[model samples]
Target: FAGIGDPERFFRSLRAGGIDVARTRPFADHHMFSREEIAALAADALREQLTLVTTEKDLARLRGSEGVPDDIVPFAVELEFDEPAKLRQLISDHLYKARERRFNTR
Candidate 1:
């Protein structure tokens, strides 16, 4: 299950990692999972004998919810930039300009 802006991307990542996804349940980006919804998902996984997996973002949202099963797994991903130095420089330039503008305003 995934509740993210691009659930397909998450699913694709799982497939790329060689995980055989038996099923999926996607929700709107940042959709808060209610206890009942969690229960239903749990029931489905139990019935199918499959594990529950979700993205880190979704796990953050489910943190405080009651009856959240301990077996639920959170999938974490890291971004790999093709040009790390260029990307770092771009971010540095953007931050410098934003800081300059903020200081100039004062």
Candidate 2:
């Protein structure tokens, strides 16, 4: 969800299609932030008491360095189908199961 355009619209579309999104962030495209910028972003996250995250694609572009924190997670969004219902259901199920597995292990 990070480093993409129109994340609000994207979330709205997801909601319209019956998908529930707890949180979202849309960082600038190709956002190669400096150390200070990374610290600022992390500080913002700390202030909100929310985890900082970005897209895996954006991470790839960043050479795995800069202001991004070690705790920052990269959200990978994949489009498997053009059909709306099937796509949403598929993604929702996958992420739900994934999250359950993640927390259950903890």
lDDT of 1 by residue, 13-77 (tens): 99998889999898999898999999999999999999999999898889878999989999889
lDDT of each: 0.93, 0.67
Please write out the lDDT profile of model 2 over residues 1-106, one tens digit for every residue.
4555655655565556565555665666666567776787778778878766565666666556755577876655665666889978999999999999999998
- At residue 61, what lDDT does model 1 achieve? 80
Overall local distance difference test of candidate 2: 0.67
Instruction: Tell me the deviation in Å of residue 23 in model 1.
Output: 1.1
Stretches of candidate 2 off by over 4 Å are: 5-25, 82-106
Superposed by TM-score, candidate 1 places the C-alpha of residue 3 at a distance from the truth, in angstroms, of 1.0
Misplaced by over 4 Å in model 1 are: 100-106
Candidate 1: clashing pairs of residues: none
User: By summed lDDT, which 10 consecutive residues of candidate 1 come out lowest?
Assistant: 56-65
